[model samples]
Target: MKQLPLVYHKKILVLGLAKSGTAAAEILHELGAFVTVNDSKPFEQNENAQYLLSKGMTVICGSHPENLLDEGFSLIVKNPGIPYKNPVIAEAIKRGIPVWTEVELAYRISDAPMIGITGSNGKTTTTTLIFEMLEVGRKQPLIAGNIGTAASAVASKATEENTIVTELSSFQLMGTVELKPKVAVLMNLYEAHLDYHTDFKEYTDAKFNVTKKQDASDWFIYNGEQKNVTDYASKSKARKVPFYVSGKMKEGISADDLYVYWNGEKLFERSIIALRGKHNLENVLAATAAALIFDCSIENIKEVLSTFHGVKHRTQFVREWKNRKFYNDSKATNALATKSALEGFSEQVILIAGGVDRGHSFDELIPHLQNVKALIHYGETTKRLQEFGEKQSIPSVVSVNTLKEAIEEAVKISKEGDIVLLSPACASWDQYESFEIRGDEFIEQVLDLNE
Candidate 1:
């Protein structure tokens, strides 16, 4: 196990006892730091804090004490979900105390080389595929960050012989200052998360932070087709590796109707891979560029791509019902993602969409809805989408009260050779806690039909 450097006996405050917070506290404690953990939940209710308390660390629960900042703490590690508007965090910043996400701390302590992936969409799918590709060569890569496992937890067990494949988000990257991955991938960029960020520029800059600390020796894999992505790549110090959809690039990966080419060399045929859509193909190209640069064999990469279905909740094909194919794309929490999901199917679709209103215009999705046989919308954005669907002359448009109702309506109207898709164009927070819960519910409902 590797101990974090420059942390011995330093007073550290870990705010919010989430998974990342718990891991950060443990790592700090292991490094001989005087760690104090604080959470909004009551002490008895906070299971993570209870375990940390049992480990002899100080625990404060139910409230965040503003005066904790004056206790001569050298640093504060904050959970990324906690907004900077939190009084304690703002106070800490005012005091000039360093505030970091657990990712930054993980980078500081990790002995392993890292491959960081970030973008608007395709992060989980690309990250998972890259980890599988690296594992093909017995590389023992640890997957972390937005993909589920906390990077701080992974870093504790990482060694120089291993590699960490991380799926970073704009939320995670915004707090990072010196996190330089050996291979950084910026998949396509889109206007997203304006609800959390100040505006589009802040969101774009946050995603680009994945490359901020890289040098000339590092590789930056990006979408050559996206001008926003290419614009960001030009400013990065890493060796630029571009991936394209229509034509070949001079220095990276590209795909045509048949094969995926890496630096103009044939890598894998498009037909063999299991994942669908041009978006997923872009994800494969990005991963291929990263894997090839890491010395992974083309055969190993091809093996994974051939059998890899896809990650859950992102255009995942569920069971067919009455010859109508069902897809769970609950992770399509933005307009661009839903647009991508719609492009995969050739037949007219019975689309289930609409969720929390992020104030984004669904105008981009209108063109993609041209082949829709029916539009079933639910949650906060239902009325807006239902109205838009009707205006766009989609054959059928219905507004439902819940996700289950939306699915039931779609199932009722879906015909043979039509696609039933759950590709919500907004966040799930208005109805469900997260996209995973929403997707699980859709799967459970669809599975019940089999009975």
Candidate 2:
């Protein structure tokens, strides 16, 4: 399916006119697919759908009309964020029309082989690291997928010389049926997105789909530290390559605190990795494993590992204010991620957390709060988290109504040598539209302190 201008003249329905959906619609139309775009937002309000309407393409805005599904469409390209429980999607499945995310369509048309990375956490860091390593090796890697850009956007211009290094989410991978990469990395898995997935097993299976369609020639790089990750990788037909933080691996990547050993030879000092947090070491190992499978030079891996600090919103260092260091980890939308953020800081921290409750307990976050000097809670989970912090004997646990208030309170309580960390352990739906927006607000507030 590497044929140029694929999906030509085939009737297709594009659901959800967000980034991925809009990009998919434009490219599908460009590829000559008889495209009809749909989104839940009204045409007047949805700039994306409105833009598509002006492109001489058929668009149904305001709602996903059921009648549009029966327009002799051969395929349905859906937005990854749109849940499987969506009525139109469920109906499309019932009618035996194939459903795919833009990633699948992009995969079918991409001229370059792909290196797909997916896990519960650290995917962005690992994917960015691999992209840098590939770039150093002159692989002409195009980064896409769940990170930001749609895969098809990169695929539309790719050639056989390029390699697409994509960050796949369970949301993206679950819809993929034929997407296969030359190198697939499963960093690790944790219970996440239970709000979207039906259950833990379903989420696990969705992430494991990265290697489901690979053949023996392809490589499956997995976290040797996680039995679950290894267990799922075992089901893949691809050759298994395990990366670990403990013990030596004769064929894959392994690391201790000090050094990273790749295939029994010392690769680089783990300390050279600019990214903090022990969990990030696992990401380093995963990226190193994938780079090695892609045949990247060892020097390139070392160089990238030494220089790449981290991705934005994942332990991103904002700015030091009044001798106190501040970190923005607004991407920490779950207990595990917040725990990882706290693990990165050795200094006593003024922690700001809370948001929409995902019906999970804050018990998983208690152990990581030993270094927290103060806790500022806000949004829906404020009371519960403040209570939890009080019960845990935290020195200061204050509840606020908004994130801005939480940030201001954190600034007042923090002192020199203390770190201000915004590691919200819940979703951002209560106040902001996305984690990126929440993180931006945190940064904006922190930047405002200079005045």
Candidate 3:
């Protein structure tokens, strides 16, 4: 491997000085580009800006004004969180300065071919699955994107032979028009991030962008289970390869409990292990599709996936307290996910639920709550779900302001074989740092009982 000369020359404006944004700023600065770090957070609040200023780079805090756009700049590297809704970005577009996401900047820097994976759900599971599959097949891949590491961060350390298995969010893909991956997996598109996009169509369009730049030489693998994804993918110009868990894939892969059959041929399958439900099955299939496209041995993929227990936050089984089993699905941040998590618990469940609602209608999960023994509510949307529970006499309890209180109340009412589940179908911003933090705290509280 050779250290290539930095290609960026002109001044670059890096916006939204968050983790990904600041990383982009430093990377661009390292490339010898005159970097101007911009963010909406005030100077006192933005530790990144102060840190950059200490490092001798020009920093702009509080807002991205029109004057900054008017300033001669070669490129605008916008953070994933900064959407089209931002007035400053709107002004930038009006000024005709090219606006790019941190991910696009990441792709531009990397010489390695990529494995771009995006969907409404199952992204983290599938992303790690692909990375593991490639690893088992002897490819040292850089697993990155919204799974935590910025794409730019991944690119900073990438090599030619090393592949990138990216778990890209719609926000990351919104500005990506030319990121061509060798194998692109559009896992499954559904009603998500309606709070961010103008409509479902806009959101779906953003997820679909992963395949928009792919050529005929590249392959587009997707779940045929999602009608919207299947329909739009059929109309897409990319070389389509659709996979499914329920039925056969005309050009891609199909799955049974034993093996993932490709075009009616035996590709790969593993012995059934302790994977919980249907959602996980779907995740394995999506990963297998990408692995097959990348030339991974079918047997190696199945062997790894079979051994892979589950991700940290997605339906992670904590421990049994007093013969009562607890399932932590703090990653269930939408209505669809909550519905899926509740599918396995056929008996009465003491559900510890609610958080800041991510524009989800409770109606989608209402039918699935038939067996819920008690509904313990907390966070911003607690009352909304509690009121719904009252209409059906589901024995709802409201906690004063935190998830801990909700769990304490649910535990009191819970019986043996009665699942006490923390599948908050909303974001944790109102209560904790993120869903992962919320999940960790939930596990901590459960474990604290022993102490």
Candidate 4:
């Protein structure tokens, strides 16, 4: 790992304590920084805070003391989930103290180059695909950032021969200043995450940060079909490589009904891809571009694409029971994601949807619900989604109190050759702690039906 001289002997505030925060705090302390770790969870209940305290770092828990900024800290390394609107962060900003998420620190310390992937959806699948392709091709790739592992932790051990395939989120990118990946992939853009960001523009601006620091020597692979993405690519200094799912693109990656092409040359047959959905096609193309840029062989890319089912919780196939197939798409946290999941199936779908109402309309989902035979709604948007189902003339529409009940109702209504899918069109925060937990529950419940 490279030396981070900027943080050496400096007073640094590590705000919030999750995977990213804990990693950053520990790294900062090891680098000889005077680190203070703060988290909103009470000290007794927060094991992470306790662990850091045991390392001789000062730890504060339960609340953000209004006067905490008076400690003369030179930098604040915050959790990506913690908004800048937090009073402590606002004060730090006002005081001209630099604030950053751990990704910036990861970039500074790593000996390896990074291939950063970010978009509204499909980040996990795309990041996993890149990692798998590189692995099969015998390229040393380390997966990190928003794909479960902490980028800083991965970077500390990364060598110059390794390639860090990082799944970046808008929240993580918003805190980055000079993080330039060797190959930056912008999958696509859509309206999302208005709760954390001020507006759609703010969200898009954050996503653009992935390629903002790249030079002409680096590569910027983006979705050419989305005008917003293309417009963003126009401003990037990197060599532009666009991927298309609709029309053909001569200079980059594009796919037709028969084959997947790379810069006008047929690289692989489309039949070899196991992943479903047009959105996934977009993801596959982007991953292919990144893999090719890294010198991964076309044969290796095809091998990975043919066997890789998908990332968990993002339209993953569960089990088949009584001639009925089940899919867990609890990662469909927005209308667009649900729409994409629906489009993947030609079979009649018994869609189980509804969760935390982010005040976004479900109107965009109506057109795609043509094949939905049954709709089971739950959580905050239960009534709204039920109404949506009825308006779309679905044969069966039921409102349930919970996901378990929704699954029960879907099984009863679903017939042979039908899909029982849990692609909630909203965030899981209103019911489950996270989409992963919600999806796990769905999988467990589905497996229980066997007994």
Per-model TM-score on C-alpha atoms = 0.93, 0.90, 0.87, 0.94
Tell me the tens digit of each residue's lDDT in model 3 across 268-352. 5434534566787777777887887778986778677767866887887887888888888999887778888887666678888
- Local lDDT at 423 for model 2: 90
| Model 1 RMSD vs true structure | 2.2
Model 1 poorest 10 in a row by lDDT: 1-10
Q: Model 3, which residues run further than 4 Å from truth?
A: 1-7, 54-56, 235-237, 248-250, 257-259, 266-273, 320-324, 345-348, 356-360, 370-373, 379-387, 390-402, 405-418, 449-451
Compose the digit string of candidate 2's lDDT tens values, residues 1-451: 3543546888889988778898889888888888898888888888998788889889888877768777988888999999999999988899899999989988888989999999988899999999999999898999999888989888889999999999999999999988899999998888878999999999999998899999999999888778888788778999888887776667788877677887888877777787778788888888888888778988888899888877888898888888998888999988888888888788999999999987877788778878888999999898789789999999999999988898889888988899999999898999999999999998899989953
Order of all candidates by TM-score, from best down to worst?
4, 1, 2, 3
Clashes of 4: 0
lDDT of every predicted structure (CA atoms):
0.89, 0.87, 0.81, 0.93
Model 1 Cα lDDT, one tens digit per residue, 1-451: 6666567999999999789999999999999999999999998788999999999999999998768787888999999888777899889888998889999999988999999999988899999999999999678889999888999999889999999999999888988978999999999787777777888999899999999889998989998888999899999999999999886655688989888887788777888887888899999988888888888998898899888877899999888888888899999988888999988877989999989997888888877777888989988998789788988999999998998998889878977888899999899999899999999999899988963
Best by lDDT: 4
lDDT (Cα, 0-100) at 117 in candidate 3: 91
Residue 191 local lDDT, model 1: 76
In what order do the candidates fall by lDDT, top score first?
4, 1, 2, 3
Model 4 reaches what TM-score against the true structure?
Answer: 0.94
